[model samples]
Target: MLFDRRAPYDFFSVYHVPDVVTQRQFEAGIAASGWYDYFEQVNISGAALSPVGALLNNVALLPPTPQGPQIPPVSPITKQRVNVLGRTMTYADEGAGVPVVFVHGDVMSSFLWRNVIPHLDGQRTRSLAGDSDKLPDAGPGTYAFATHARYFDAWMEALDLRDGVVLVGHDGGANVTFDWAMRHEDQVRGLAFSEAITPPFDWEDWPAQMRPQFQYLRTAEGERDVLENNFFVNAAPQSITRMLTPAEFTEIVRPYAQPGEDRRPTTDWPREVPFDNDRSQTRTALEAQAAWLADTSIPRLHLPGVPGGIARLGGRKRRLISTWPSLIEAPVPGLHWTPEDAPHAMGSALAEWLRSLIN
Candidate 1:
């Protein structure tokens, strides 16, 4: 029998098929059912095992584990603090090899990469995810993208990470990554972005429904929403695929719990968005970044979530791929917060791309 006729519950719960079943029977049954080949291909391609591969590997009846190469047990993530730009910066540094620096976007800290970091090849890459200075409790400073980029530089200098660094960014983090990379192009080995803010950010490009919301964010009413009502923190659940458990939601909003100027980073980041023909420093930096992204020879990767949040509003993906010479597109299924929803897919694609850079 393909599955244990005696224990149907075991098959459903633990994916356990008794060893008494012949390998051929199991393989035949797996082949008869589609998706086996898809997982096999994902494994063969050197990406981390998908959810189905995890299930197949649990079966004692299968010989020669089908889930590609074995992944080492992920080490527990430990938070470390370092003084950067005269302020204490929190970051998670684990594994060892070529450095892959992960920069998170607005309203998120290094915590965002908790699931994604382990998917990287621990043997071949060192993962560094830093909480920017703008985040609550990270110390006071101007929360502009340029200031954040400078802090990124200082943090790297403090760590002595001068060269051969791969930058991975999301949302506001992506903008910081682009700004930092543009200034220190020689130090960056590769770039990866998900739900990022790229160039040609015209007001007309924004979706009609989102325009009013963004416009509101640029006003005093938006400040009240963020500071007093905790709008962004409360609305975060709507951006992702799954509901955040009570503990999860609490942990995410913990930093911003206190009211007052501590929440300025959350508010200021939205206003920094370059809409229309604005002549702000943010716009100037992005204009310069656009030119660099177009001409740079460094390998670039763009992982767009299917029907992504921000990048999906306009023809952002199409424009980015067309403009960037070395850009590689890898689409994962999710919404805005891909790391929260499609962690495995996002991490696998990131790992595969990072591997390509080194080999």
Candidate 2:
């Protein structure tokens, strides 16, 4: 009486009848059969109907049950660090083909490009985002562009990344890249900048609204405010349209969270606003970079973010963009953190642009 004799697919045909009628014994007997093994292999997802045990077909080949979306797990990233020019620099090297180097701005490190580098496939792209907070102090009044440029140049040399390498710089790092492009124009194949600062524009010329903010950052009180409050680290995650997850925020802010005055780079950066054309290293470095931007024949890309925000290039940037006929300006959607805020758009555009150059 336990068998449904009239059923089309008889369950008893696939399973052996056991003398013991206990459900556990029945299951064990069915499990030993090849048909039962085949059914077990077929994954049934979603809610299975009771009584008749009906399952809606999802994957047609297998007798389907209700199921949720299958999302693949993401691979973990591995960070690489090296002693370049006596300072420890961190970067991520991935993919293959053309060599592209990514440089990050102050208050941020290579982690900024986490969402972008993967898109630059078919090329060996290394995102170099060193934490200057941990670097040895280069004495008081030392300008970041001059000091960091040396470190960056040394890093390139250490890696034997000499000539024909594409350089992409973001925010303050653009200044460093520009300085290098000017000094060693022959070494670089092309240049790309996003939310960058191009000189000839001084703190005095800074937008009326932002001048006070910069002025405050020049003070000792500002240094305390920045460190105690985690200004750079906290600001970036919040400023973007898409707020970063807690884990992403933790990784980005890790370097700046370290104790001691070595973290002076955070405050030193705001103080080094290239304004005067006098003997100031800041002025000299920026002016030279400006000159390079004006004259270099190298292919260039500029991704201008929304104006008026923390890192978006404003009027000065637009004016500079106008003069460089060879520089290709690509519009990106975002304020300061284009890589994080607009990864898909930025990455795909960048990849297409780079491919065009290669072909």
The candidate scoring highest on TM-score is 1
Question: How many clashes in each structure?
Answer: 0, 7
Model 1 quality (TM-score): 0.76
lDDT of each prediction vs. the true structure? 0.72, 0.63
**Cα lDDT for residue 47, model 1?**
24
- Model 2 alpha-carbon miss at residue 264, Å: 1.3
lDDT of 2 by residue, 303-332 (tens): 765442433445665666668858887876
**Evaluated with lDDT, which candidate comes out highest?**
1
Candidate 1: 10-residue stretch with minimal lDDT: 41-50
Residue range 230-249, candidate 1, lDDT tens digits: 87667666666544546556
lDDT score for candidate 1 against the true structure: 0.72
Evaluate candidate 1 by giving its C-alpha RMSD to the native, one decimal: 9.4
RMSD of each predicted structure: 9.4, 14.6
